[model samples]
Target: MKATTVLAVVCVAACLSIHASALSPFGVGRSQLHKKRWWSSVDVNDLHKYHLDDDPQGYFGYLTQPMDHFDPLINKHFNQRYWVVDKYWKSKSHPVFLYEGEEAELELGEVAYGHHAEMAQAHGALILGLEHRFYGNSTTKEGLLLSELQYLSSQQQLADLAVFRVFAEKKLGMSGTNTWIVIGGSYAGALSAWFRLKYPHLVYGSVASSAPVRAQANFEGYNEVVAASFADPIVFGSEKCVASIRQGFSKIEQMKQAGQLAQIVKDFNTCQDMTDPNDFKTFASDLQGTFMSAAQYNYIEGNSSSIGTLCQQMMVPDPYQALVKMFNPGSTCSDVSFKDFLKLLTDVTFDPGAMSRQWFYQTCTQFGYYQTCDKNTTCMFLPEVDLDYYFAWCKGGYNIPSSDVLEQVNFTNAYYGADNPRGTRVIFVDGTIDPWHALSVLKDLPEGLKSVFMKGTSHCADMAPNDPDAPPALKAGRLEIEKIVSGWLMQAEMEKKHK
Candidate 1:
């Protein structure tokens, strides 16, 4: 889920195990959090095989990475963490599958239990997952001061991957013989595709799952897709589900207009009074975000029944009460303070656990994926959660002017070519139910660019380990990805033989 405020920080924790997408500031209901890690279900034997028992870090290693890849004068370097699985690697000719890290820390589970591991076994491939700079323990400096964060951008990240590939090749004794394939989900997914586009010589192919390549400042389409997913029958959502959501928001708006702040607070169980208009907007945004998280991660493993339950709850006569029940299950008081959220976002003091400040900086200067509700007429969120709200957050947090934010967004699209990235052997995968798909490449493009658009699936659903209970489309999609990857390796071998 993507939003403007630190709400994404809260939602990231909720959905992190399921998908590697951008975080949203919107608070996730207690019930929405995944009970177990996504990799917890992986076969124990496979887990043992992938685990690097000899290393103290256990499948994890850190590389000395340049702080500024572009600036020769800046000699500062940091430890960039990575995980590796070479149990399936047969020879120097075997392919290497690299998982690009995103806004969060690099985890061993990423390479140990996903479809990448399954594919690595099938193809005798070496698997690696690299941590993105400034995220997790891959920090460049002591703090997240705006000046320090200047080093964090997609271009620099791609350069890091390029340099790391060379270093990894030397360390693994493969030099230049192995074919490298990059794989990632969500933000990391975008990096995968962009890596191929920017450094095709370094990577043979890319599996970009749920990657939103396009950059939009006022990304109202995010919530628009969320609203659509509420009515999408594939996820067991109905027209009435969407209507109830609208009704719920409408009731909140009516209450605010009638000056029933106390009644609203009592019903929603907010931690603080919503007397301030900004606080009221934050409360509404958090409510809308609960639905966003539900839709964003709908139908994945533990979450398969959540959307259905949400829809059922929304259909209750008093939708306002039902909405409250949906998010504040167990009747917990929600922390809906806009001022506190701002403090979190604006604070530059480095807290490895809280990545919202770093991510929001990226949004302000690079992607501009500010999800606003004002642009869409049928938006289920309050109008007060508009672009101006996000703009205020951006300005307050980073001192980045709204005009500069828009310019940077335009620059990002211009630099990356938005959705029409010129790349080969790239498969762009997206699930219909994922709101982030609005900005991904959903159709086939020239020069071997393809899309694996799955129906009734949510964010990065294809990357999940193949389950017996998984949908047929998802299983087929995985097979199709394998076939494409196999073909790439075979073609590379054929070219090598010819040479």
Candidate 2:
């Protein structure tokens, strides 16, 4: 991908865990009045609005994650919190559907309203949602201590899922023939697809929605896609809007260089005028994150559209004012400020949910997935997220050798075969606009393994319920996904009958 006339492509043009790309960790502190963490809200109304609570649609339980999955006899295990919601069908032959939870807690959107739900009804299957370890209550503890967090790797959770499958099979009195299909979006999606590869016999098939199977330490293509999307004429975005965004970025860069701290503080409504280069960089990152989050979650449903809304606002005449418009829509004052708009973050306890910190730990130690920008890069909003951040996290957070991160990441890539996932029954689904898609399997694969890349779409659009106003590409993608999954079930059942 090149730096097109509109956007930068690594100068122009990538996550480690298939985790949902994040916003800047610059939100105000947690609400002191509310003990609930961000995303901890369980109300259905709160589900999509940045809420990250335990499964509101299901119940919770515990499963022990092995300290060492390879050594079964070495039983230094910790109980991990697990959640589930089950709806069984009449016939014993009905298949089971499992939604692999991601960095955020589990939600029922996949099961209650999407193609997965429709399939569950069509097959009269059992639907279950499992929260990923360390996200919800599924942890040795809060993971405050480095020792406790060490076991929270993807490999450890994969083993944990295998154990759950057997326990679930017996508990449901499922016959040898009744098969299970793992399903998830984002990190969970990556896990779902990989599970089948790692434990072929355990799951009949998988749907990895927006899964980033490949782990790259530097992923810059993310911003390039955002640039591409902004210039996409079909989505109502215009090159004018793209140019306005570019101008905004350039203006900010100029401001910082000129030591016009007072001007920037006035422009984005910073809490205070920042003179320090590091503080300026932090502010720039937060600004860039606004674009990252908006672009990645550009799915449109009815009047609700994330990227569309932001792009429209970018059309505001002045770049600085345009930024405030796009990033702080809630503000109405003639003299608006960014901090005033996000006053909640002012709370010291402010962690919308602890997932940001948690995911950061995983990335530094195992994934090396930093969404960086550089001379050859394009996410115009962010600076080159220095390798120092990863090094510091590793040394300070885990007391581990910083140099070992690359080696560990290499070993992990080899262990999982991200470029060449060895699997028989998995479908890799991705959105053309999703930055993570660069590291995911976007092309067709082996006989039983395949891929679906949807255009004019954003992250995980297929994972949600089929909105009446959804793009035709997603509806078509879901149809193909359903057909593929149906075939896998038939194959699994046929094998069962022969046995």
Candidate 3:
């Protein structure tokens, strides 16, 4: 794809922008108070005005970068805590939550800003974090009303980016002239690539870390990819570990079949530094975390044997800590057990009730070329089995999908990708040790795309750990990025230069 062609695609996409309806239940702003950061209340009345000052008692505003469009009567809304509500209300405004490496939000928008900031700071770029639509303060409403929260989708999220750019440029004082780079890991990384494909004019460059854009969204298909990677001798070091893994998985599968899935999971949590918990909350949380950790990585290899091998490594004594780090990083786990670790691998739920499961189903039936009715007024998923249920299960809770998300709202093109004359640059950073490295979208990335395969990380490379200059190898790669992106942006700005 030529640079000129890429620029044209971006421009054309931007020309087809959508604006949020001011009267929608989601457009009003309200505020609330909290100790850490003040949240605005959700306004149920007017949607055009964005109120910032009506915060609840005891909350402090945390946005370091000031916005001029902020209004006491109308711009910002508050909640008990914006982060939690911001996540729940996504699909309103693109919400951005900063976790500071402690409480990581799994939402794609939050990760994008966090990862982008880390990378921008490393490269000495002036990082102005932009929140996505239906998230954070960017929502059309004051708070997350269960009824209004159902419209979240990738396409809506992308449209929100254009709306946000207009808002940020006018309120946050950015000139769209400035180079905007989109960065993210895992699902968000996939979004970054999709964003460029969808709205090239808004982004100057894109960094997609540990890309997970798969052709099919089936559990069996995803696991096959992971199983194949594990089968590769180079990734596993030895055939013995492979055989042991096979035996372990057979036993684990038997446990699941025998109705001992929950027990094996309980024992695994008990091994996590052995602190006696007053309730089963910690155990359940740990089990879900372990399960997701394994499920996300299952796409790297092609079968059960490879997954079995990976599980065995988590139980061995010499590399136990390493395994723990791989499976459960940033959390305490000094006393966890082999059974505990095994539970994590076997914990994946392919039942329609699981979110990851629902995600694939909803996305596949709608956008994987299956073509159902218009997604705007009618839905492709049945009310009983859908992504909401799956998401609830992942959070270890049950959140009934209200009529809000059950409506036939369009989410089909939310994360779709298309080839363009302007060959889009797609960078995929994978941590070698991160199990997810096995099931990335790099293989499916459009033929002419540019990519960066970061060594030693699960997601995208934020920056090099010890030497902040992005490590030597990344520095070299980014140089090419700088040249390519700078040239592309300059071409867009200068009509006569490339002609």
RMSD of each: 3.9, 7.1, 16.3
Total backbone collisions for each predicted model: 6, 30, 79
The candidate, 2 or 3, that scores higher on TM-score is 2
lDDT of 3: 0.33
Per-residue CA lDDT of model 2 for 401-467, tens digit only, reads 7667777778778988876787688898888766667778888887578999998776666765544
State the C-alpha lDDT per candidate. Answer: 0.75, 0.61, 0.33
TM-score of 2: 0.81
lDDT preference between candidates 1 and 2, better one: 1
What's the distance in Å from true for residue 388, model 3? 14
What TM-score, computed on C-alpha atoms, does each candidate reach?
Answer: 0.90, 0.81, 0.48
> What is the C-alpha lDDT profile of model 3 across 350-443, one tens digit per residue?
2211122223222322322111112131211111222332223223321333232222122332335322223365555554433334434433
Where's the lowest-lDDT run of ten residues in candidate 2?
Answer: 1-10
Whose lDDT is greatest here? 1
Candidate achieving higher TM-score, 1 or 2: 1
In terms of TM-score, which candidate is strongest?
1
Against the true structure, candidate 1 reaches a TM-score of: 0.90
